[model samples]
Target chain A: MSHTRYRVMEAGEARRFPPEAMARIEKILTRYPTKQAALLPVLWVAQETWGWISKEAGEEVARVLDLPPSHVDGVLTFYTMYNLRPVGKHLLQVCTSISCHLNGAESLLERCGKRLGIGLEETTADGKFTLVEVECIAGCDRAPSMMVNDQYFEPMDAGKLDALLDRLSREA
Target chain B: MEKVLTARIGKKDSRSIDTYLADGGYTGVKRVLTSGMTPEQVIEEVKKANVRGRGGAGFSAGVKWGFLPKDTKGKPIYLFCNADESEPGTFKDRLLMENDPHQLIEGMILASYAIRCRNAYIYIRGEFYDGARILERAIGEAYAKGYLGEKILGSRFSLDITVHRGAGAYICGEETGLIESIEGKRGQPRIKPPFPAVSGAFAAPTIVNNVETLCCVKHVIDRGAEWFLKIGRNEKNAGPKLFCISGHVNRPGVYEAAMGLPLKDLIFGAEYAQGMKGGKKIKAVIPGGASAPMLTAAEIDDCPLDFDGVAAKGSMLGSAAIVVINEDACIVDVAKNLSKFFSHESCGQCTPCREGTPWLYKVLTRIEAGQGRMEDIDLLARICNQMANGMTICVFADAAIAPPLSSVTKFRAEYEHHVTQKRCLVGARAAELVTV
Candidate 1:
């Protein structure tokens, strides 16, 4: 509920994992003894191919791994990292866990909301960034940590996030 | 204390295998293979080393390996290295993995040989994408160096190490839950009787060790057991321990000291955290991770940062994640935040934890938001009791109760203030925080 909203079932099925991902999946299969056990990685490949895990995407993963669609749904909904629908290109995950909270993560979050013109779990008007409060990332040592998509930034404040947002916006 | 685990951490190119070998890494497993050190002999050496699991449970590593059946009925044994360190206020494992991954790899190789496991996996947290990449590179390096794969170091012993990343689920930190997640299911914990050692990871005998525990194993093999024994306060708590200090400490980071390092020394020691930030006075300290009970400032005067030492103070050093709270923090708000974490992470299996966690969160949410009644405080306590003990398959419910239960008991006046006055006790500093 705090992430990608539920949209109506799409008319047609999504495409299968791309050729590159299929190659990656082939290697991932060797690591696991069973096909079903590679479900998480295969689903991750699907998400990487398409920005999100659509119902069709789930079916494709199920078909690939020889699992039922319901099992794929169960796995998808249980983990928070997967995208049920499309998310912004840049996911601004700010930490609001106790350690970050003590280091003024709440104020940083509020600053992000004010600057982005969006509340929690909301993407900006241009859809460049989606801001969400995350749990304690292992960077608690730095406190008030945030991840700009994949890279971890430490001891973030309003100024740093604002500058980063400005730069990210200018690029695209 | 000798810094076996962290010795190569800050060195140049620490994560590379070249640096690792320069510092004599992978020698432990090489010695084990070339010298014909039997699996039983390796286990005996570890037992004599007296190194406890750096994971929360603090079980002796040797005793746990000894639990495997003598005759496995030909079922292939497996080893799972737990790198899913999502425990709030805990990040020590991330350090070892990111900075000097070869140390962990060598440790896993040694552990796999000791347990006669041919295959092993590192179940790292998905949020740690960067850490995972670093480990993947490190594993590749290890394989290229002939330290892993079949006929490792020219001996009959062979091993394969794979790094498996988990999607975001805190429950996966639980060993059984980890087993289930690696099996490609929702991270729900299994009921224990067979245990992971008996039936785990595709119905094979398995041993799940923490990142730090395995790292210690490599050192315990390199250094004799007697040298390992002399590192800590006692035989029960021996080895170099990585303490993750966060929150209001001036120099919050991972510090590796001998086991049983004094609590006050970590927070105020000149070589450690130094002191509280901005000259703030200490209010409460969570000695372990969020799952451990909170201790008042006065109670931590003589606290020792070890499994038993903290347990003696009615708190367990569950991962040695020290979260220091300054006087400006609202106790009710702290409890509310942690309760929300447990609520979000509950796998929703047991009726008690599934329902009780959200109930506790709701009441605390109301209380922290200035809508609580006087009865809500006691209701929080009653709800915690229902979710713990044998009521659930895993200790998650028990852990879910620690934050709220400990806060309400230790800081009842703060809760009372929030309820009656309809505001946080630290209202003066509320302007500095936006209260997300």
Candidate 2:
């Protein structure tokens, strides 16, 4: 497996929340009594706005929440969801935990790798899909599950997974 | 016993405010607010019902609420509903949040009133994007209906609930770790003595409860405590419980059964998992989530599926997640998979857990790959002993050790065969089929 570290967005890169994101951020801020308590929600807003959370995005969140840049970086690196580098249009997070593994998640992942001609954590040549093996997404009842973007697809075998990939490719 | 907790799940428009209100929802909170009952009375009622936390700990919910200092003159009390359901085999919380959002909301309001808190937050796991959106919409509907916000239900009580999403960390399921994550830090469990009730969430008196536990609070109020106590086997393990059955089962899904149901029934009963898939003989069972020790097929025959029952059998009813393993799968492989999970998810705040978990994974991987020495077996046990109990700040380290140690003890011959033969015997057949 490739061990690529999270890339840092260079200085002078333009990164600011648009008007709609600002409105959402304001609404989220009202939920918490303190500005710092909204840090995770605000970081989510940043990630939603910029696909992945870059260094510049982290700094912007820090500025908005009045937190230190190092603190933002620490929190960002701790969680697995915040992507620090740009990803494909569709992020396929396959659950490789025990239950999924028992139900053929490894073979399903291998099939994805074979079909896409890319290994786990690699993006497709066309930038349509990025496959990453993740921990349990809590869909054990329907094992060998994966999440494309934010939606869940489960009980997937090689044929069904291939069909899903073909459909996504055509849609994209 | 009736399905009090998950009764509304799978119903049409179950998440909407109108559907919730039409079904006599919000009555629990309304009764609490409108009646002349004090916070202590609410706590006493809950205590009488014996509602235990659905989260792994299974502590008494009412007793935990009573931990708050009576006089927090200037300090604000906070109530956090832990929606961070990331335990490997646990998925019951997501169903309640996604389907019966108002049930949880009503529970939260009653819990807040019992603790006399004005602010509450639901720290949901990051993977549950759909559940979070549904809960957000439900909260909005609640606010619009005046079930929440200022002077709720024309009573002096008021509460504002917020939905905070965690960014993929299993440690956040721990109450203290959850508090730290909501505070915008690494999700690490804090050392106790200041306990959350003493000082939590912005250093205020806080009471953190699981999503299902809070939902049970709604029922404990709607139906009297005596009624709730009469549903399950006994007062100690009262009320309907949600059991998440997965792995090797014919119908692997969430089943709501009375507490203290037999483990064999949950696995083989038609209403539960409908027996193992393909008529395969059961080899072992992980009674709880990956954290609890595995029970050999023989040991699980008549075991009770409750906190005390499972504990009596040398395991926990943690999250009530039962993962059945058939004879086809390798025990060594199961141990290795769980080791990898714990090692990856460890917050690395403690020395034994950070160093011990990865070491356990490395040794297990080596053993699974046919490179293990005989001494590695005793070494593995030694490491587990060191990491278990109160050796660390939290139980994460202890949980990490359960799979490997338990598997080796219960299935020592399997580990020995892998080492001596330099190949996985049980997995060899599957590998051969794959090659063909």
| TM-score of candidate 2 against the unseen true structure | 0.97
lDDT of 1 by residue, A17-113 (tens): 7788889999999988899989988888888888888889889999889999999888898898887767788988999998998888999999988
Model 1: lDDT to the true structure: 0.88
Candidate 1 similarity to native, TM-score? 0.97
Each model's C-alpha lDDT? 0.88, 0.89
* CAPRI band for model 2: medium
lDDT of 2 by residue, B1-436 (tens): 6678888888899999999999999877777788788889999999999899999999999999989998987999999999999889889999899999999999999999999999999999999999999999999999999998999988888889988999888999999999999888888999997999999889899999999999999999999899888877678998889999999999999999899999999999988899989989777799899999998877887798988999989999999999999888988899999999999999988999999998999999999999999988888999999987999999999899999999888777778777888877563343232210
For candidate 2 chain B, the 10 contiguous residues with the lowest summed lDDT are B427-436
lDDT: which candidate is best?
2
Candidate 1 clashing pairs, residues 3+ apart or interchain: none
Best model number under DockQ:
1
The complex in candidate 1 yields a DockQ of 0.71
